[model samples]
Target: MLHIVNKSPQERPSLDACLRIAESGSILLIEDAVYAAVKGSASAGKLAEAAKKHRIYVLLPDVEARAIADRLVDGVTGIDYGGFVDLVADHRACQSWL
Candidate 1:
């Protein structure tokens, strides 16, 4: 499955929802959601834990308006806008976590 996330921990319900998902194979960070990896993001540790535990692929656009794309965490993969589309084409299903 694929997940498109556009919310950070500053938002509550959605953050909780994302943690509860059973299968989010590839997670795409878009818009302001990219801040989840920025320094001091409250959810960074939790998000990292989720990725490791579930083996979920964390994908973020190579260029983000909110955070330094090149500084993405170890488990996160940098992708382009077109790559997001390709991921959906390659997956059987997708869910927008935002």
Candidate 2:
């Protein structure tokens, strides 16, 4: 299943939602959600680690806005805008956390 989130790691249980539902082949992170990818974000790292440990396919974008786009850690695949839209379309269900 695909879960496209666009919130920072600390707001309104976005991380909690991810932890509760993310499984193998789950897609995560979008827009502001990418903040979690930055270093020093515990929930983000934990989520990524858990996804990897479970072989879940976690994805994020590489666009830079408020900060440089290099904050996303290893293991999370970065896709282009078209791919992102395709992912959202292919996923079917969506829970907007932004």
Candidate 3:
């Protein structure tokens, strides 16, 4: 499965909610949710935990737009739109954690 989180972890619990329910699948952070990929951000700890069981990914455009592309968390993979499409195609389904 593919889990997409687009909300800021600072403003909403959607990321946490998604992480809790996500299994050994993939978590894609886009829009404001990309902030969670920053190594020392408030939500980084939760992301780290999520990484233990799931493959974590961050939208490259989002991360670069936020200017944190170079500081992404150790295990988070940064992907482009093409990569996003590939992920969606690779997974059987997707869940959007708005």
Top lDDT model? 3
Clashing pairs in 1: none
What 10-residue stretch in candidate 3 is worst by lDDT? 15-24
Tell me how far the alpha carbon of residue 29 in candidate 3 is from the true structure, in angstroms, after superposition. 0.4
Tens-digit lDDT track for model 2 on 45-95?
A: 676676664322334333466463666566666677777677778775756
Sorted on TM-score, best first, the list reads 3, 1, 2
Clashing pairs in 3: none
Candidates in order have lDDT scores of: 0.65, 0.62, 0.91
Ranking by lDDT: 3, 1, 2
Q: List pairs with backbone clashes in candidate 2.
A: none
On the 0 to 100 scale, the lDDT of residue 35 in model 2 is: 67
TM-score of each: 0.77, 0.71, 0.96
| Residue ranges of candidate 2 with Cα displaced over 4 Å | 53-62
Which RMSD values do the candidates have, in order? Answer: 2.5, 3.0, 0.8
Number of the candidate with higher lDDT, 2 or 3: 3
Determine the backbone clash count of candidate 1: 0
Best by TM-score: 3
lDDT of 3 by residue, 1-98 (tens): 99999999989999989977778899999999999888888988888888889999999999889899888889998899999999999999999998
lDDT of 1 at 83: 77
